[model samples]
Target: MKLQVNIQILQLSFLALLFFTPLLHKTISSAPFAAVLHLLSANLRLSLSCTICTFISIFYYFYTRPSQVYMLNYTCYKPPPHRKCSYQVAENFVSRNAQFTEKTLDFMRNIYLKSGLGDETYGPAFIFEEDGVPTLNYAMQEAEEGIFSSIDALLLKTLIDPQSIDIVIVTSGSFSPTPSLSSLILNHYILKPDVKTYNLSGMGCSSGVISMDFAAEILRSSRKIQNVLVVVTESITLNWYSGDNRPMLVTNCIFRVGCAAALITNDPSHRRVAKMELVDSLRTHDGADDGAYRAAFQEEDEKGINGISLTKDLIRVAGMSLRKHIKILAPRVLPLSQIVHYAYSVVSAKFWGDESKPIVPDFKTAFEHICIHTGGRAVIENVARVLKLDDEVIEPARMTLNRFGNTSSSLVFYELAYFEAKKRAKMGDRMWMLAFGTGFKVGSLVWKWLQNSSQEFDNPWNDCIQNYPLKT
Candidate 1:
């Protein structure tokens, strides 16, 4: 009986082993495939998360980046439809007649006559009719009327609805506060009451770029803002000083009645005329220096003549100030190619101790054209040397100075018009505008042309192109 029971147990054990062996083999065979499937699932989840994060990062960058607006079109105020009349200057005007002594006349002749005002032999010429009253007040009135009319003509031609403009920037050197020129422009144009407006006064020749800088900042901040209208004019009539001082007499020779109105739009959607896309701007003030302030200042020495003494140091101060500004600004607008070349030159100069050969920055790589302030011949010459620029690069400035004298704040625009009229600017060309003002300030504005600008009917360059390559 015991032997039979043991035999039954052994038989049951054998049957169990046979049934479980195949199951163990199958489990071992599938383990590697299961491990691979689990690893793939984890990797897929990580990849999806990374993709979503990358999309969010890209979207954030786009939303926060500042959008650059190309200047769609711009129009300058045309003088008038009337034919050009012969304008003359009276030698003996009201305030100046009593003050014109032999010494004063000699000084005036030296300053105005020799400095290139038509011919002294032809006598002093003013821009008014002979019968017209020669008072500063009268001149101001005429200038105001002419500017308003020109602006009206421009507005009519542009056909831009007054209500659509987002901002109006007005700049003038002579008058401020009482009857602000900006208010006069806004009221005459019948713009909206709440429309944003800025009146920049006391800035002198640099005001135009200052106004442009302000307008650019506004556009940079707000997406809703589009159109910006800038008016730049100099009221020489109001500030005429009849003093016997040489500085006071300097103004009589150079300044003339001139006004320019430009319409700049931030709307990229509109594409009709040449575009000036703003790239970079810089401003430097050396007001703390007494020499700079005295270089261009108004001094009254008990004589009623309010003379603005333009010291010989003015050009030097301007050059120094410009160098300072460029040091701060070059890294911003200059391309990496230029920066690399400039750096190599500097390192070579330093390590090699090559004091004889100075490294000058190659501005040609940065700008195709340059418009230096048309202040005077000396100023233009000095700037050209400092930047190592050629005469062709500064021709617009020289020509504008010769034709229009010093239009102050609007000088750069006139230079730009000259470039356009000559068809010197090509698509994708870059321009640099440099200006100096009363606060002993130097400012720069950089722009890139969006398209070629053909000669427009109203362009000032049209009339002067024939005479140009002028005797300057």
Candidate 2:
């Protein structure tokens, strides 16, 4: 009996050991899972803490954030004097009298005649008379003073607080030192010494767009930037070359005293009165060639004759530069709809084996308005032909050139203002601005109108439009 009892106990012990052996092995093998459970518990505590911290951060952001000032509205300041000038009859003065070579004069006359200049449909307007005379420094100074007064008047009329302007950008092509135009404006406007200021000199007709691009960059970087004031003008009085060079003589006839000030704000809240919002800008330079630079440079030859000569190749250079500009910009501002149309044209041209076939992208579908630089009549006509724009679409540019006579960098703005005065621009209208300069540079800016723009009764084109004798 003692042996049997011992045997039973031993059997039971063996069975108990057998049952616990598997559980022990599982626990040992899954030590990582046990550790994971501990880690999960710790992470849960951390997650709860993080949630509380996030809630507190959000609360702080809402309660203590700084008040933001959004641009509520903006307008181009047109002082009464400028308004009067716009309405007044422009004087026909021949400041110089160097006779153009008969051949050159005839060539110019033919170009002028071929241009829509004689079309009565555009009506009688101001035409600058070229005299073979040199422009003087005093004349430029006088022009500058007039511009300063005009800017002051416009600023006052616009009712923008002088103190609120954070930056000032001034551009001119003439010798702009010894009293930089920017200093003159700061003093006139009583801007604070701390205000950010920049004076751009030597950039010819393209300076206006260049200045705009620079301002946009500054605005994008600093949230504190509220208002940017851009002043564009040319001093034809100073750079008048008295030489017999036909190119220099051309300036004697074409350029006039003109100044324009534009106020731009990045604050989205001020979209109402703002005529247009800048969309895209492009600049291209072909500085690799000396010929491109010489195409528009001033030369001081013997006989004290100093003036810039126009090269016959300038038009070709401008065309090349513009082609380069379009290549880079077409991808950005061209709407997907326009892009699709262009793509279809490309594919069609490729399959048809007609590489010479031109694919004129439908710009009308993309832009409601176009403002090509008013460099000259021929330049305008060339661009119009390339773009396949109607004469009426280019009317504003032509009229601006007829009246203002290529006011340099500010020409585009003048054209834009003309459109506004005509009441032609409706809300949601898109405008494209193209300009070329001495750097053999071509640049463009795209804008969309925010509201209805109407022509002012006192606009320069008012009388001309009424008498415009042309029909489509």
Candidate 3:
């Protein structure tokens, strides 16, 4: 119906142009003006006719195109052999440390044990090596190893040649080294020279979702089918804190090394083998305010030691940012009934002079599954409270946190892998991925499962799927 309207508009516009050009030509009697008008009208009519035919052709070409964007496949990095940081080993590493005061050591231990982290989470740089001194060389090596392995697995699983990727996006919140992460992928894969590449830094943990939105928008606007490879990872090797600042101390306790790679494409041929279809995405930022901006800040401490400081206001900021994000997102995804109820509540509260706050819409009605960022226990709990979610709904986030720790930008993909491993996602089910980043930014992506996913060999949970949902 819409296409027909556009076609009709083109036809009408062409007829008007053709009719006016000749009528104007006839009205001009002077030789000079008449010839000029005649030439102008002839060119105008010809151009209009060409444009009309072009529009018709282009519309017909697209009208027959497939209607889905596919996430062909994705893989989360499983840290190489012997890189795992179990609780006992982490405690021992702390015990052996001469830098932290006993009081600070105890605090770190408390956060580590209770941070929803498990024994399998991996650390970067010298933290995992036999010797515990970090070096720039070692940090780069660790980053490269993680990126290569993850991307290799993703391409292998998808059976896509590296040369086939047309776009590359790499995001790491804290660490972006020389020959940028995207450049590293280009050099490693030897992709085509014309491949467009983007390196996004300082976008925080929500960058994974941001990258997805970035790729989707680009693919949607492009005339030709294209594949975008998005690599989401964080650099823990160089960001490690040796400082005693309490806020900075918490980062050391919770964050671990992780990376994830995904292949997203607008190519209709790949939809048959894709896991999910990108449905919708939204992002909201609250960093304009000082408090929200400083909630999770990175800077050098008094001694000039660099690290991210997780201020006490972070959880509060997260809650506020999420509230703002959902406000815009609800209208896009929520059903009409729920939307009407929310509207009535708002109207009643404002006009009726009711003191009660407006009702929170039931997001459960919008999506079958939700992948909330595993920022920490507090962040997860706060999101659950705001959304009024049940324990089952938050299980993936909790389990992902426990198993992988805070993987920075790549966290949500790990949670999605968990859902696939558990076989919780089925064809036609809608999944909402919500992630919070250090810029105090909130991002959301909605996806519809294209097919039922079974356990894949590269699944990080393959070894211990049976042991999940650990009692808190």
Name the best candidate (by lDDT): 3
Q: List model 1 lDDT by residue over 401-435, tens digit each.
A: 77666767777877778887888888888889899
TM-score of each: 0.82, 0.73, 0.87
| Per-residue lDDT over 1-472 for candidate 3, one digit per residue giving the tens place of the 0 to 100 score | 4467566656666665566555554566455666565565556656755666566556755664334577999999998758888898788887777888899898899988779888888887587566787778877887788789999888888889888899999998868888888998999889999999999999989999999999988987776889999999888878778888999999988988889999999988888899999998898888789999999999999999988999999999999999999999999899999999999999999999988988999999999999999989888999999999989999999999999999999999899999988998899999999999877799999999999977999999999889988876
Order of quality (lDDT): 3, 1, 2
CA lDDT, every model vs. true structure = 0.68, 0.64, 0.87
Q: What is candidate 2's lDDT per residue for 202-298, written digit by digit as tens?
A: 7889888888877777775565647888888777656654455556666644555566777778766666666677766678888677878877777
Q: Which pairs in model 3 have colliding backbones?
A: none
Is 1 or 2 the stronger prediction by TM-score? 1
Which ranges in model 2 have alpha carbons more than 4 Å from their true place? 1-137, 302-304, 344-352, 456-465, 468-472
Runs off by more than 4 Å, candidate 1: 1-46, 77-98, 113-136, 271-274, 345-352
Cα shift from native, residue 414, model 1 (Å): 1.0
How many residue pairs clash in each candidate at the backbone level? 4, 13, 0
